[model samples]
Structures are given as structure tokens and as C-alpha cells.
Target: MADIFDKKPIAAFGEMAETGARPYYRTAAPDAIMAGCNDYLGLATDPRVVEAAAAALARHGTSCSGSRILNGTLPLHEELEAALADFLGCEAALVTTTGFQANLAVGALLGPGDASFSDMANHASLVDGVLLGQGSRHRYRHGDLDHLERLLAAADPDAGKLVITDGLFSMEGDLCPLPGLRELADRYGARLVVDGAHDIGLLGACGRGVAEHFGAMDAVDLFTGTFSKCFGSLGGLLAGPAGIVEYLRYTARPVLFSAAMSPASAAAALASLEIIRTEPARRERVFDHAERLHNGLRALGFSTGPSVTPVVPVHVGHAVPCLRMWQALHDAGVYTNAVVAPAVPRGRALIRVTPQATHTEEQITRILDAFAACGRRLGLVPERAEHDWTPVALARPKLTP
Candidate 1:
């Protein structure tokens, strides 16, 4: 008999499990290592975060029991929303059950007259938001201001356009050219929305994000971020002008219908925010770990893409070879990610690596040693360094387009 599972190609991960070469989860013994999670701050294990969550769970019980639009509007939710507004310096904020929902709610609420211009590399949430908004949407090439400018020039000047982009692209770890993005939006009279899911607590003066990085905080129209990443929580938020927020609270089906995030997650996120302000070193440690890995990989003659942030991808451009390196790294107890075609173009195969603020020097060294050993084992690295080899990790920045 024909079977659905039999006809479907094996999942990339199922193939790995078949080989008995890689474990499906991060290590927990000795020193645990998680390669692909977005926990940039390492706050999931922090005592204060755990305590705050425990207190919230004790006070509020297990769940909110309803949507926030109705009976779910608990005091804890209000407190967290208020804290977020104050913390991010926005006029108002609406916390959603997940980061995906925050973007979805906002994108869905921006009525018929509005439109959105998105970056090509935007996260799935933002893309989903625009799709649900029921308005016109156009995506300019990743970070190409020229492409954005040209598109704006061609569109009606009076069109209500929202320029949306990820502050720090998740795959490349490079920041959007906010200076240029802001200028184009200004020239074309469009509002700007920055998806700072990968930016907060890792960029800018106090981690307010790209606006903080580019000194254009006041210029952005809306900012959205996730609690899952640096905050070590599971909710999402939209911080922006008061009226738009109040409008979404009443409308936006996702916000209106979705159940509230648990009190524990909300409280944990609130505590993480306090720590973000008090301990700036977490942000510094992000850079420290990034530099060590970036410098180490470059020293070994790997083709790491332009990675200004902690996320790094070394291009191998062939699927089989890329998988081989990923398998080797996983077997060596130094975990990593394998990115392939369609998610990227057909010719661009990558082994993506992320370093957290809490990663130790020993871990960093282990990671490099694994990559070096794997590269040699697979003949990806020459017997000796290429005569023309130069460290390309930070040698040049690619303009998004």
C-alpha cells in the first residue's frame, strides 16, 4: 500500500538521526551546549528570573484562563506592559502571547489605507503579519537602500507605507543600514517599524536596539521584540505610539482572540528586563564571545560571511559537503547548524554558528578546534593555509539588497 510517510522525503533531521551521528538535543552534563537557540543572554538559568516566575506562578496559578481582551487582563500583564513601555521609551506597548503574535497583531491592525515595505530577509512573523494585514506589501532587497529608494520613488508619494526590517538579520548577524533606511522613509514620508527580536539586550547603548545604535530612536514609528531570545521568556511585545496600540488592543484578531501568556513567563521577562539595565556586561559578553569565534574561524581560512553580530555562517555552497561538516561537528561534541537551499539560494550552503554571552573561553576554543578538525577531515581546508588567505570575518560589510 502507498503511504504518505513513505512518499515524503526524509526531513533533514531525520536523515541525521538515521546516521547515529548527531544528538537531537543540546548537551546537559559537565557544561551544556545549545547551538541553535536564540537565548543570547543566558538568563534562562538566572536565579532572579526563576524566582520571579515562581512568585508569579504562586500568586496567579497556572494560566490566565481567557484572552487578554476580556477576562485575561491580569494585573501582572498590565505591570509587564507598563514596564516594557517605560523600558523601551515608547508611548505604549501591547504584550502578545508570542513574538510571532505581536508582529501578526500589528501587521493585521494597520487598516486598509496602510501598506508595508519589508526587507527581504525579515523573519517569518513579519512576513506573516504583512500577509494577514490585507494591505499592499512590497519587499526591497535585504539592506539595499538604493533598492528601497527606487521602490519608494516609483510608488505613490502619498501612499501610507510602513518600512519594516529586522534590526539584526538572524542569519548573517549584520545590522540593517538603519541610517539609510531612516533617510528613505523620511524622504518618502513613510513610517518605520524595526523588528528587534535579535537586537534588544545585544545592541545599542542600553540595548534599546538599532535606533539606539544609529541615534535614531525617536525616528522609528514602532518597535517589536521577543522574550524568547535575550529575555529568556516566551512572550512578544509591540511598543509604539499610544493610539495605535489602543487600536490593536481592540481590533487585531490575534491579540483579540489569543490566550494570554502565562503569568510566570511574563514575570520572568520583567525580571530579565531589570537585569538588562543593571548588568550591561551581558551585552559586552556577547561581543566578547563573538570576537573570539569570529577571529578564530578567520584564522583557520574558512569562508565566514560578513557577520557583524554574534550569528555567523560559513558558506560551503554544496549540500553534501555542508552536511558532512555539520555531522562531523555534531559528532565531535561541538554542535552547530546546517542551512541549505531555498531557505538560502541553491548555491549557498552554510554551517551557521551562534555564540551566547555566557559561552566560556574553553567552549569557544572547543568550537574552533572542532571546525578546524572537520574542515581538514572533509578536505574543506587546504593542507596548508592558502597563500592569499586573509581574515574575512570583518574585512568587509555587505550592503543589504
Candidate 2:
């Protein structure tokens, strides 16, 4: 038989060495600026965070060796969960092996005659959670409350309903309207769930997430987040009322079957969480970097959609031009993610740029200069005018894995 993986799109896959927020790809030199990593607060390589992880590794070795429901439960896990619940203002929280599983566990709450209303542009994990559940799924246009309301109005009056959205969209770099979602969920007698994977440690006064950013902390019924982003570690968490969390603790397959988060990851996440709480300046610096980059890209005439978070998307229309621009930037010592196809709509490709708190003003200037030169060379932005480039409408291309 022909190689099953031969047709896979391996062009996007590559090996690289990462140190904290900076990545050293084989195609780029050591000094390449990483604008693609999700280490929003730059705590991944912090001495304190690293020390915590090292200590845990020395104490607990490598793996937890079992699921959280079994012998895998550790004191560190409980401590991290408690800290997370307290930080997010939830009554209880459960830690999972991965952020994807945390969201997947949401499906445990769904049953026959239930419904989940999701944003069209929600993360794949959220989409998969609904798919794995027995409940009916309804996806509204991204951030469109009217479409959500319509779907809610059409659902069975007695069915359990969940309105799920990402606190901050990873690819688009836009925040979900939490206040509006909360209002609609209340009006429709539905529970609201916000996935804060991309927002938790990078948003709000206390870094609680978009719910806290919009002053809708109590408005949301459930909150999910990943440690891989802002926490500078690997794991996931789901926080909510004690009763519901307890139910999933014993019931959700993702939590019950998967191996528990390693002790090192748990410790690192705890350290990072503490840092996020105490260091308000880190959040400030990240927001500053985001603003500078966004404004800089926009001023160079790139179409950066409505994004006010650290995740910024530079729209570059089709895949070919997007890859060309990415290559040009890579050659110029600026690294960014080249997002294309199914990650977005068929034709809406973009260069995903995420600035870290550790980046200096001088580095930000260099990044902007690289983008200005590369964008003009690739014809992805204007040569002179500061006006946003009008995205071309292209035919939908056939998608592949």
C-alpha cells in the first residue's frame, strides 16, 4: 500500500529548539525573534519557575504513573487546583493532563436532550468536546450574539444548554463578548462556559481572563484554561461549582482515564500562578508589547483584525502569499506562525504574532522593521499608504490534513 502519511501537509511541520519564549528554528539563526510563541508572560524560563519544576522532578521523578482518579492523585495537584480555583474565584477546580482534556471533560456534563451553543471560530478542542457529547450542537457566527440568541430560542425549553466560547480566540486574536454571552445565557436559561486557554494569565487586572476583563466573573458558570500558555507549563484546569466539579472528577473519561499531570508541570504551574498574582507589571508589559506590535503592523498597512489582546493576526489572504511572507520574515530573523486553510476559513490566511512580556522595546522595533520590509517586498501591505489592505476574496480551496 502507498504510504498513508505521504499526503500529509508536512510543510508546516519542523523541528526547533525553544528557550522560554524564543525559538531557534533550523531555517533561522539563533537571534531570530519569536513572535509566534504563546508564553504570554515569559515565565517558562524564569529561574523561579524552572527551580520549582526541578525541585518537583527531584522529589517525584517523572510521570504520575496513573490517572487522577486512581493512584496518580498528588498533593501538588490538589494544591495547584486549589490555587487555581481561588485565583479564578471558583468554588472548586479539577486539573487535567492537557488543556484539550479539560475542555473535553465538558462533554461529560452533556446528555441526551441537551444542547451546546458554540462560537463558529472556537478552538478545535471545544468543537471536539461538543462532537464527542450526546447533546445537539449549534454554532453561531463568531461573536455574533444575535445568531446565538436565535439558536437558544430554538432549542428545547427543558434541555440543558451550554453557551461555550474561547475567552480570547487564538488564531483571530479577538476576545469573545463575555458580558453579552452572559446576558443571553441568563435570558435563555443556559449556562455559559468560557475557555480561557489563551487569556487566563494574559488578561484582566488579576489575569483571571476575559470574564474578569469584562467584569463577568460570576456571570460565567464554568471556566477552562491551559497551563501551557500563560502558566509556562503543561496541563489544563476546569473550575466551577463544587458539585459539578466533583461529578466530573469521578465521571469524565478524560480526567478518569488519562495519566495525571506530572509533578514537575504541577509545580511549575503553581509557581507561575503565584507570579501572575504578585507581578502586575508582567501583565502590563505584555499588553504594552501587544499594543505596540498591533499598532506597528497596522501603521505599515497590514489588515490586523479587531484584536486588543497579546495574540495579533496579520491577515495575508491566501496560503501561498502567507507562506511567502512567513519565509521572508524567517529569513529576516523574525519568526511568526503562518496560519492557513482550515485553521481559519478556506481563504482567510494570516500570520499569527504573539508578543511576550520579556521582549524589549528595541526588539519590538526590530520586529516592526522586519515586518515593514517583508510585507512591502511580498506585496502583502501597502508601499506607502497607511490604509489597511483590503483582503481579496478567493475561491475556497480543498482542505487536507
Candidate 3:
């Protein structure tokens, strides 16, 4: 009989040789540039955020010790929720121990006689949340509004409907077509829910996220986000109507069973939120870096598909070459993420790079130079004329929120 304790997958999963804060990592190649982090504003290591977290640690110790519904609710949690609701332009917000739980909490809203229409490329948490619910699930091709509309049109009109998508696709780095989604949701009498985990602190003029950027905040019924990204902390939040939030606060299993977010995380997120509100320049700087990096990579004959955000993916077309490219960059003092099979489609493997607002111009130039050299060495770079090198327009149009 075969052994039940098979561990091949675990063995294949390699560990990070070095880990540290954003933009740089101490490794064998010396000060390796960290291009895989999601800290868009670089506030994770900012003194103000650090100090706030430290103060909270001193005052409240560590864990909240119980679920929010039990003995764990804190004033900080309430304060954070209030601030998040106001910032995201929602009536109320509920904080969860992690972003994954926040999405799971949304599943609590689903039941029999309901349906969830999800984008195929949505984050795993969103996929899992749909699975957790009792609703019938329907998945459409990524960004395929026509397909989504077809699915919606075919569903029973009387059934409760939820249209779910990511505000910014983590791997593709493209913004969702919120305006179209809004129209579809309204036409179908469906509630629209956007998970803005990657774009909340970086996209809109007021940093509200893709919905705000596209003038569709009113179109969305609920918004979910995580502090682990631009907020420079840990925890997740779901914001929406006061009644819906209150409902999830009572019925969500993740909320009722999981421990409350630590005091330090709440304080750090609160401090980071204040910084995000006060400092618009950080948002501008990160976008500039993204454009610069995207343009530079394309100039070197590497394909960056449909990216307009900091999360740029360099398409390598296969898992083996993708891993080779990652190792080459890593050995040359540039660190990036190797996204392979299960995360993305097979033969669509790529290197994921994200730049921070705090990265210096020299650092950006160094990253470009490394890619240029590595691409040439790996024969990944073809003659400029041989490839379709048309640049993607990265400029954001001015808009008032």
C-alpha cells in the first residue's frame, strides 16, 4: 500500500534564503533589491508606524485573547473600523484578524437561493469564500464583462446575486473595469463587492481604491481590503452598509470563532492610515516607479502584460525559464517573485516585481540594468523590432473624488 504521508510538494517548496524589510534584503548577493514586496508606500518601516505599534505593545501587551464577539473587542478596533468606513466611503466597517477572514466573513452573507459570480482571476481568499458559502457559484473569465453578463442573464432573476472581483489583479496588475461592472450589477439587480486589497492605498486621488478611481464607489455595495499591503500592518477589513456590517459581525464564523487582531497591528494600521491620508506624494512616487520600471522592462524586450500598477509581471512563458530568470536576478542582487503553475496558468509563469515609494532612483536604475543584462544572457531579449514593443500608457487622468 502507498504511504499516506507523502511530502513531495512540501519538499519541493524551497525556503527564502534571506528575509527582511522592504526594498532590500541581506543575502549572499549582498544588498539584494527586494522587488517582490507589496509595501507600496514603504510605511511598514516608518518611524511613526513603528512608534505607534510599540506604544500599543507597551500598553496592551500582545494578543486580544478572545474573539471580538466574546471578551476581545477593543476601543482600537472600533476606532480603526470607524476610520476605515469613513476613508472607504462606507456606512460601517468590520475588522477581521486577517484579510483572508475578511473575505470569509463576506461568505456569511451567502445562503441557499443565492448565487455568487466571481472573476476567474480573483484572489484565492475570494475563491475560498465563495466555496464556504451555500450559494451556487458561477465563474467567468477574468475581465470578461460580456461573459459575466451572459452568466448573470442566465441566472434566475429572483435569486440573490453577488458580483465579486478584485479591484486590482495581484498578478496581472490591471485595474478592474468598475464602470462596466457597476452597470452590469445594476441591470441585473446584483450587489457588487470589490476586494481592493492591492489598490486601496495606491490608486485613487484620495487613495480610496479602483472604485473611487473609476468613479464607481456608489456602484459597489461592499469593499474588502487588507492592512498587510500599503497600510504597512496586519489585519483585514470589510466595509459596507451599517446593517450588513452588523450582520456579519454577528453571523460570520471567522469573526465569531477567531481571536481579535492584536493591539500592535491595530495601532500600526491606524497610524499607517493617517499617513496614507496625509501624504499624497507617496502615492504619486510609487506610480512613477511603476511606470519607470514597466517602461524599462519593455524596452529590454520583456513582456509586461496590461500592468498599470506597482505590481508588474514580466512574462517568461514557462515555469522552468521563469525559475531560471528568478535565480539569475537573485544571484545578481535583485530579488523578485517566481509565480508558477498553480498561482497562474501553466505556460504563463512570470516574475512579479513591485517597487516601493521609498526606493531611490539609483535603485530603480540598478533593477533595470540587472534585468537588461539577465535578459540578454538568457536569450530572453529579442531584437526590439522583432517583438511587439508598443508601450502601455501609464498616465492617470486627473479626477475629483
- The best candidate by lDDT is 3
Ranking by TM-score: 3, 2, 1
> Where does candidate 1 clash, by residue pair?
143-400, 143-401, 144-400
Candidate 3, residues 324-355: lDDT per residue as tens digits?
77878887888888887678987898899999
Model 2 CA lDDT for position 157: 88
Alpha-carbon deviation at 401 in model 3, angstroms? 4.7
**Residues forming the 10-long window of minimal summed lDDT in candidate 1:** 392-401
lDDT for 169 in candidate 1 is 86
Better of 2 and 3 by lDDT: 3
Flag regions of model 1 displaced more than 4 Å.
Answer: 1-32, 386-401
Estimate the overall C-alpha local distance difference test score of candidate 2.
0.85
Question: Any idea what lDDT model 3 has?
Answer: 0.87
Please, what is the TM-score per model? 0.90, 0.91, 0.93
Backbone clash count, each prediction separately: 3, 0, 0
Per-residue lDDT for 54-148 in model 2, tens only?
Answer: 99999999998999887999999999999999998899999999999999999988899999999999999998888878878899999999999
